[model samples]
Target: MSEFKQLSRSVQGLSVLVTGAASGMGRATARVFADEGAHVAVTDVSADGAKLVADEIGASGATARAWALDVGDASAIDRVVGEVAAHFGGLDIIVNNAGISVRVAIDDPAYEDAWARGIAVMLTAHPRIIRAALPYLRKSPCPRIVNIASTEALGATALHSPYSAAKGGVTSLTRSLAVELGREGITVNCICPGPIRTAITERIPEEHKIIYAKRRTALGRYGDPEEVAHMTLSLCLPAASFLTGAVIPVDGGLMARNA
Candidate 1:
């Protein structure tokens, strides 16, 4: 029994929906899910980028598709959730990886504006997806929902108020939902990553990036896309089924340091 458990592909033949699938952690996660024999539907604001990933998955003979979606719109989220569920018969997993970042100081007057925009995409949109998919997820034997967050959920960022606040909401929402949905067989958890190289992080001033590399992380290095992708797969598996409402940090020992 233990050997069979060790060799089992927990996600094989499951249908997965991954947001922000055009690039960064989301893209990496989508590919990883497909590699594990899950049919994946990739969604992002970038149609071209999402289509490119879908095409790659298709070329590998995996079931995949892409949709251009603005996570800010609840109706749009509902539409895509319904579409994916209908396409795949039922949605066994939902990876809420779509998010937006805004660079603004905490003391800035425009912080409210920046924070609102970030919330629209990062924090607000995820519930729309869960609400829309609850029916389909309830039908599945094993249901998983993974929300991608950031180290900013724990550490403060002077120049990233909006991004930090949004991610903080994600961390909170994960715990809240876990308590509410645990008995229903839907597992909810958040992965708070630190200093991942992505399109959004490239905009960070190099000097500041290096400073971040030096200060926050003990390893003094940024994590790779694959590392975060592995975390995503781990969260949705049956082993993690009993692990709900936990904030799993995949950062390279960043949370351990007092400095």
Candidate 2:
């Protein structure tokens, strides 16, 4: 067999679970893994959206299943992890890509509640899900965990204090987990994305969009979801075995500019 073909077969039969796989970067990441021959568990808060993505993968002759997941709920996280692992025989990879961004100023009346929820889902859920999946991950010869953080984790931005704090926590968590799990043969890493063109960004006002498009990234354009997905796929490969505790950015030179 050709070398590329042989390498492509490496992930075959390996099971992957991507949270928030219904749309955006999560969906793109799930699709990339499935396309590369992994049996993927596509999960999201939106059952219909998750099922649709799963069905699409299955239709394309890949193994995939849809599951409802509300990452902020501890019990729901536990239940989904257990069920997906059981169905897949054991979990080999986990992508903690589920997150929400609430952009309210600290002085706003709704700030406290929004901040709490954002932290719960974006920061707290990462470790919770990892702890639940540890047993299953321990069984795999090449286990991996990819936490989806944001560029906000690296710096401050107006109207995004809560999200920044939560993602910063995620980055810290990724580093700690990588060290703790290294000896167990599991590699944990974080991907910090910036200004990706996703459903979330579509809500920005047109004038704000133009300004962000021009100034936020060095590339002077927003990135595509698939671009982030490809970066994610790179980290999941066997060739990335030496990489862990790494806080890599998929931003279009945004973080670099900040540096």
In order of appearance, the predictions have TM-scores of: 0.92, 0.93
Cα lDDT of model 1 by residue, 227-256, tens digit: 999988998886776779989888878898
Clashes of each: 0, 0
Deviation of model 2 at 184, angstroms: 1.1
lDDT of every predicted structure (CA atoms): 0.89, 0.90
Scored against the true structure, residue 173 in model 2 reaches a CA lDDT of 95
For candidate 2, write residues 1-259 as lDDT tens digits. 6566333326777899999999999999888899999999999999999999999999999999999999999999999999999998999899999988679998999999999999999999999999999999999877989999998999878999999999999999999989999998899999999888788897877678668767767787788999998888888887678889999988888877742
The weakest ten consecutive residues by lDDT in model 2 span 1-10
